[model samples]
Target chain A: MTPSREQKLWMYEKMLVSRRFEEAIETIYLEGKKPVFNMAKGPIPGEMHLSNGQEPCAVGVCAHLEPSDVVTATHRPHHQAIAKGIDLKRMAAEIFGKATGLSGGRGGHMHLFDPAVNFACSGIIAQGMGPAVGAALSRKMQGKPGVAIAYIGEGAVNQGAFHEALNLAAVWKLPVVFVVEDNAWGISVSKAASTAVPENHVRAEAYGMPGHLVRDNDPYEIFATAGKAIAAARNGEGPSLIEIETMRLAGHFMGDAETYRPKGEKDGLTLRDPISRMRARLIADGDADEATLDRIEEAAQAEVDEAIAFARNSPDPDPADALTSVFV
Target chain B: MTNTNPARANERKLTIARAMAEATAQQMRLDPTVFVMGEDIGEFGGIYGNTRGLIAEFGAERVRDTPISETAFIGAAVGAAQDGMRPIVELMFVDFFGVCFDAIYNLMAKNTYFAGGSFRVPMVLMTSTGGGYSDGGQHSQCVYGTFAHLPGMKVVAPSNAYDAKGLMTAAIRDDNPVVFMYHKGLQGMGWLGTVPGATNHVPEESYTVEIGKAAIARPGKDVTIVSLGIGVHQALEAAKRVAEHGIDAEVVDLRSLVPLDRETIRASVAKTGRLIVVDEDYHSYGVSGEVIASVVEHDLSVLKAAPVRIAYPDVPIPFARVMEQFCLPNADKIVAAIETMLGRQTVGEPS
Candidate 1:
């Protein structure tokens, strides 16, 4: 479906928010690395897997989901969390390890959970797939209209949980949409070298579900496919698999040297960046003006700045409360 | 004459499997959000008949029979629980946990704590455990110690029909993730010979047996016998045999492994001055060892002698009946351990 000018502006704003938030995190991470690099000495004192060039995948898929619809994401989840409407202030506080964080300073960047929005992320590879199936099963059992979205990296499609969750969702006809953000690398190993099949979407046919591949970093194309799959799932047509081909603009982790990447690959990836491509398309089609797009970017940066400030102002959790929350 | 059977009306003799089914069915009926999903759990009534007649009553939507995928269903149960649905996911055997340990340990158990108490996984992972009918190593393991060792899970192993019903009820209502393990031998199946008293009087109305409590099967003063699941029956049998020789033995059935009733163990051991832990799990670094350490930590002076433990040797369960019987903790082994602890002549070797 062709999105209106307003919808295009909203998408641009959301993607900009994600990009600026990630950039802020990266800057803080590097600042912590200055002088002497100790992982524990950072404002975000954990392994940060920033989604630098994968904003389209999260924004496209999550745009179709309501606040009640559930979404589970992988370790690299800031983009998905932002797209799924998680409070940026709380999420920033969580990443900063503050008392007012999403998990009250318990869960760091990789383990963000917002029950109000029914959003969760797991550090284990393809681990969120199982819970996504479960949320879908819950919706189906309760006769609710909400569907669940499970986001996994292309590298994690080969994990056992991925296959099991797909088979279960297919057989049970659960309303879950499995999104594979194929950025072409499982850390250092290329997807072609590690995954059994070159195209991960082909594996969906084995489970008797429709699979589609949305090539390139086009948010509109992603939105179209994701919208169809999500609509079909909500209509009780069973699960669908969507693999969106994107690129990783930065290293897998903040400190990753990225020696495995081919020479000049980093420089070449900048030409196809999703955010810039979407901005050009919006301006060319008269859907948005350059001034409007620039204003959106400025507002996004300001919002991210406020989030960082909130996180910095938040208090650290009490050391004595460590033993609490182990159980209900 | 009008039939006035208050005794039968108030309570009924139910097998462990039947009691478990009744408890789950009652929960499903009372809570619209509670549902069960597992292999052969729907139309087939479960392999052990623990979920018999549930599908017919609750329909296929709630009483679901899933493919042999533990990770998916268990993970789904966690998700559903997080989404406000109380789900009971069954893994046919605890041995099958290898395929889905990541979901159980990383997600179900740790999610609440990891989420900073913002989320609660109110789910029950019901699975069959233990072996006596030569089910081999894969099918016959009381892995309660393994689950209890994990931080997030609440492990419950009921020894009789009464506790089976009550504990199942409690596990369903509990806000945390519960690993409800049922001993296959204690299920009281006619085809599979049951341990004595595995089937007991269960109340008609719903009730809860506290998750972190211990029950005294038989009270005595000479020695304290600590056990759970089928080991409880074996300890009681040994208690009877030891009483014949003027040695009074007390049997403590530990219904819950995680919230272990250390106070009961301390009070009993203080009175008896001797302790023997009977466990079907591996000997080293298990419940038996944990019991010993708990008693020692609480008050070492209360022990009249170094406590003895009758547990399965550190090895996989053998397939051969003779070898399996030899390795498993039985009444004879308990009796012999007690005799040895009392500085008396030991009984014959385990047959």
Candidate 2:
């Protein structure tokens, strides 16, 4: 079915918003305006799975979800949170470890949480799948059409819980959608190097479910595929897996050396970038024009700037709070 | 026709297994949401036969059984609990918890608070612990002490038929996750080591005792013997022998380990001025060590002698029957430890 021009324009704007928001964070990191203990910044040596090249996956999948539908994402979650309409200021505060953060400054970037928007973040490799399955089970038991979305990277497909949760979800016919944003690499290891079949969707066969492959950089394609899977789940067809192929257009983090990736793999993917492709599609298809695309970009940048300003001014979390949420 | 009912009631004597079965049945009947899931816990009953007849009464749906994957089923229990189901997960042996500690500690115990207390996981994990039938190290270790140390977890180790029935009921109803340890050594012992006619009876009616409260089984003056689970019976027997030596010994059975009855211990130590902790698990950092630390930190003046513990050596339980016997504390060992603590050099062995 052909989507309405308004719906196409809305998807383009959402994708643009996520891409610009992540770019803002990257810039903030480069300027040393990030967390003092951010090991991913400067010369410190850990990877931050930035949502640089894969913004469309979140924007596209989440475009169909209502505020009541829940989502759980991996460490790379800025794009997902923005797509879910979580307050940008609260998300920025959380990433900055400020008292006004979504988790009251308890959870950092990877552990972001905004229950009011039904988003639970996880730093654990594939642990987010459990909570995703849980929320989906809750929705089924409550007789609600609340689809639970688990946004994971290609790397998470290797986790044991990932496999166990998927099988259990199918057996129980939980209303969940597992979106594997296969941006070609799991950390420094390429998907081909890690798995015998490099095709993540094939594992769905083991779980007795349907798996789809899509062009991850094309927001329209991702939206159409995800909509079908999510609608099937909400309609009591159990769970579905969608593995979308995209490229990483930025270093894993602001200061990542990109040693293992081919020299131009990061910059080369810029040609078919999800956000820009969506904008071009919207204009060429007569849904929107150059001026409308420019306005969307300007608005997203302004919102990101405002979020940074709010984060910079927010208060640090109380030292006493360190012991508070540990038990509750 | 009514006279037969009263005569039948007088003839019914409850076994530990029967009491446990009744408790689980009563709780499941009271709350339709309560379900039992584990390995061989259905048509075959539990390995110990404590859950016999439940599958027939509750049907296959509520009394579901699973394959031998402790991690998956335990994870399922955690998942089910999050979705408002009261799941009584049986982990065949307490030692098997190692396979799924993350599901217990990281997930079930911390999920609610981590979600900012927006969720409550009500789960009861039942497992057999302790040794006597020579199940060896992997199968027989008493590991409830490990769970008691965790913040969000509640640990209960009930000693007798009555406490077993009450505490099992309590665990199912608890808002938080509880690890209920039923000692393999204590069950099916009938009424051995009891005074001549002292009844070991549990009423047909079901009930639940509050968690974290300690029950005083036998009261005395010379020394307070703090014990839990299977150790409670050993302490009781030792107290009897101490009475034969003309020294009254207090026996305090700690039914719940986490909300440990610190006040009761403090009060008992205050009266006796001495403590002998007979713990079944290993000695290092065991429950006995914590009890002694709490007592020494608070009421040192009450301690007439250095607080001593009769605990197993810090080693994996050996498989040999003789070795297992030497490794675990018994009634005679508790009596000797008590005698030594009070400086009454030889109480159990006649001079």
Candidate 3:
């Protein structure tokens, strides 16, 4: 299906917005003028898997999915959440644990959920697969072709749930696509330390399913890979697993000691970053110019600034809220 | 004396598998939102045929099977519950619990509170438990105790076909997460017939035994035998044998473990003054401990004999039949414990 050029542009625009949002957050977080009202913003001291370099995976996959198609994301799901149409104001509020956050200030960065937008985010590593499988099962039962996408990290491949979910999805022919964002590092430990086979995609073969790798830095490649897998799943061909290869531009988290990463490695990968590639493609192809790119950046900046201001002004959740919702 | 029950008269018998299948079918028919999922529940009629004929009756959508991923499907039930569908997830056996306990404890149990009062998960987890047949240690376990240890989870351990159908119906209709434990031994033990003297009449009709309610299976003034799950049958048999010894023991069947029937226990203990709590779980923090604690905490004066609790020894269940027999509490053990509490020396003890 040839998507309208306008739709493609919108996808590109949303991707740019997500990238700029991260860039803007990193800037404000570094400057000490934190967007989070509660003396916080960006990643904590240890490790934050910044999506700055890997914007295309989020852009291409989200481009094919509608607002109603449920998505389950891992810890580094800022781009997924933003691309899926979560309000920046609420997302920033949620990151700050402000009362106005999407998760009602309970879930910080890893646990972002906008059920209204069919997105449930979790910080627990490899736990998203189960919920994503369940979401796909629910969609299938409802007779909706709503394919669920689970955005995982290469680190999560070793988790038992990752294997269990794939086995079940393949057996039941559930409408789910498992996307392993193989950034080659599980925090400080590289993929070599985690799985025997460094290529995480091959693990899917053991479960009797096709697995392949996509150039994680290319938006076009990510879109095609995710699109094919998602289509196969929605068409009732069961589930497929995709391992996307990219590199983390920042530390595992914010302020992470980069001792584990070879010196100048992040800087080197930053040269072939996905966001920069998309930007170059848009401009070189005359799809968008420097002025238009400037306008998009300005709009993203204004929106992010407004969200920070809102999060700053918003109140914290009441302590009494802790006792609520124990049971329905 | 606790109202009319035809099954008790030895006129009816039905397999636990048949009882559960009937319950699942009736629930799906009664509520459009109810569905079932497990490993091979669809094309294979479940590992035990408990879900037989369901896939055909409800089609693949309602009676779907899944990969052997307990954590995913179980957690999926939580997500599906949040969106307004009542799901009954089968874990095949209680031993597979390690793969899926987090979804029950962390996610489904506390989702409402974690969501800051914005959401709640309404799902039923139906799984087989207890050890008698040589299904090995892994397949033979009573993990309902672990579930009873957690708060916000309602555990139903029905001992017979009647309670199986009744309690399961309630669990399905429940608004919170309910863990329904099915004892492999008691499937065909309770309801002996499908109708009055028909020999196969277990009610095709549906009913619910409210949570936190206990049924007094027998009334006596000497001692109260508070038991649940397959242990209820053991307690009943012991009561009958104790009657021969001139000891009138009252039996209170605690069908639900979490919202325990403390009032029934208190009332029985108040009258009997001696309590014998029997559970298939191990001796530590199992349902027996909870029952004994509730009796002591609420009605301390009712104790006549240090509240005898008969339970399996604290150890991983051994695979051998003889070792399993030694590990589990049986009718003879319950009867002996009652005799000991009554100042009469019982079996397995030297004077």
Candidate 4:
């Protein structure tokens, strides 16, 4: 369960990359639309959902995924998309609506699809559950290797799709794992207001599957829990559900004024930022020295910068080309 | 008959239920990638007998009897299809679609398009439809029109045992997401009773009837009787009944609804100069309207008399057998509608 020196460094670097990418997206997403707050006027128009502080959830689970393994993610998908090896330049370009994008600008940030790394996502909550279960079933049926990891938010726990998918995965004994990233906020609503249960993982017991709850948004804890579940699936064992407590460092969407938030509630989330915690842990755990960690952080930010620059420089798609991909 | 399997060489007359199960068994034998799943589909062989003897032949892993969780299993079929397996997942009944339509329309239908063709969902969503035995509102329905109305889905339903086997074969072989809807009334299941003549001589071989094509069940020059599913049976009977009135009626079986046989419909209407659509689905905003619109859109001048539609009334099918029968389209109703369309019925005559 312990992360090796290299694994810790890898997780730390990935967290940094995810953080910087979200920071860049958040900035440019609000560029032209600010002050006047016109959502359609930005370089990245329409909705921008960023997974800022929830870096550990994606990094830990994806660390277990192979190139052939499938990963279906939620709307705030850049983190998982990056962690699962989506082409950075193309993904950034997709968010920018450029022709060089992953789906040729058809699917924006929320609807990212990268079959190269076997990654797909959508704006709908709990929609990924079905496809992930299916992918697991397919691989098993064909005697092919590789499991599927489906990521959803705690809010999705209440959805029938989520319940149905979990029960199917368990009953079929498919090679799949359901990861619930409990950020505790579904837009303005909190888990206390929306969820009837105190935890989503225990609900997996209702379906005869083992469920684990990872506290503190810790990457190492997530990695250990996800490692066991993923290995079990790969070894022909049944599926498992993991609920990781995480934080939303940004608003649900860019330009969302959190006026509904109680006073000082927003400030508390910044104190538990996973990236900052990971960097300190990496130093304290003797995985890296300050100099080594500094180099990794700088390199990660440089990669993010290149991706953002590539997105900005990419060409816009022709309006006529919009009708091409509706069918095969 | 060209029989691929030597054992069934002498068997010519197969019911729609047997034809479907045989088609599935043949496909499974031909391709190991194809499998069947749904509640009661395994040992119970499905309520409508669509998967009869599948589990005994294919085993549990390949022919799974899933929990009554439509959303998960259907979604898994879509995922499995992308992973290079052809999965024929049953929704159990068309009425049960409400519990799992998101997986059907969103993932199964739109994923390939959303992925820009990077993924191919070679999955077949097969389910039982139609209502003649008073299964109540929740159990009986021919809602293939809803799937046909959506984009990125191939919707097909066969009227007889011969087409049932062929269409099921074709649907399994197609790369896109195909909704293979079958009518319960025409399945020839002894318990529910079958539409007479719904069972016919079907070859015991793996063959695919072309999707999006209509069949001329009967030909006439005076008027066209356009319908599908159980309506095809009713239309044929109506055509025979109307012949006594000296009004020859053509019968067109619309096998596929999404890639609708608009060409066949238009051609039949043109030849007959009159049209009467009989459908088991609801009247407004359904396949019946789509059939009429396709004809008029291509050429409005082809019709001599105003077209008429004999469809289920826009109401929940009542529980009582008599009340449900009142809402259903039948041969007599189709005959009455044809009489009115051809200007032969007197207002006082019993329809």
Predicted model with the maximum lDDT: 1
Candidate 3, residue B66: how far the Cα is off, in Å: 4.2
- Candidate achieving the largest TM-score: 1
What's the true lDDT of residue A130 in model 4?
Answer: 89
Tens-digit per-residue lDDT, B1-351, candidate 2: 000011234544555566678889999999976888788999988876678899999997778776565655676676567656788889888898877776678777776555545456788988888876677799889876688888777889877777778888888888888888877766663432222112246767877777888988788999999999778878888888888878898888888897788988888989999899998888998799999987998968888888889888899999998999988888888878877777675465522
Considering TM-score, which of the candidate structures 3 and 4 is the better prediction for this target? 4
DockQ of each: 0.85, 0.29, 0.42, 0.69
* Superposition TM-score, candidate 3 onto the true structure: 0.86
Model 1, TM vs. native: 0.97
Determine which window of 10 residues in candidate 2 chain B has minimal summed lDDT: B1-10
The lDDT of each candidate is 0.90, 0.77, 0.77, 0.88
Regions more than 4 Å wrong, model 2 = A1-4, A27-49, A85-88, A138-145, A248-256, A302-312, A325-328, B1-32, B49-51, B187-206, B346-351
lDDT of 1 by residue, A1-328 (tens): 6556776687788889999999889888876677877777767887999998999999888888899999999899999999999999999999999999998888999999998888999898999999999999989888889999999999888888999999999999999999999999999999989987889999999999999999997788888899899999999999999999998999999888999999999988998888888999998998888898888989999999999999999999997777889898
Against the correct fold, how does model 4 do in TM-score?
0.95
Off by over 4 Å in 3: A1-49, A202-212, A236-238, B1-13, B31-33, B40-44, B47-49, B59-61, B65-85, B102-113, B117-121, B189-202, B243-248, B270-272, B299-305, B344-351
- Candidate with better lDDT, 1 vs 4: 1
Alpha-carbon lDDT of model 1: 0.90
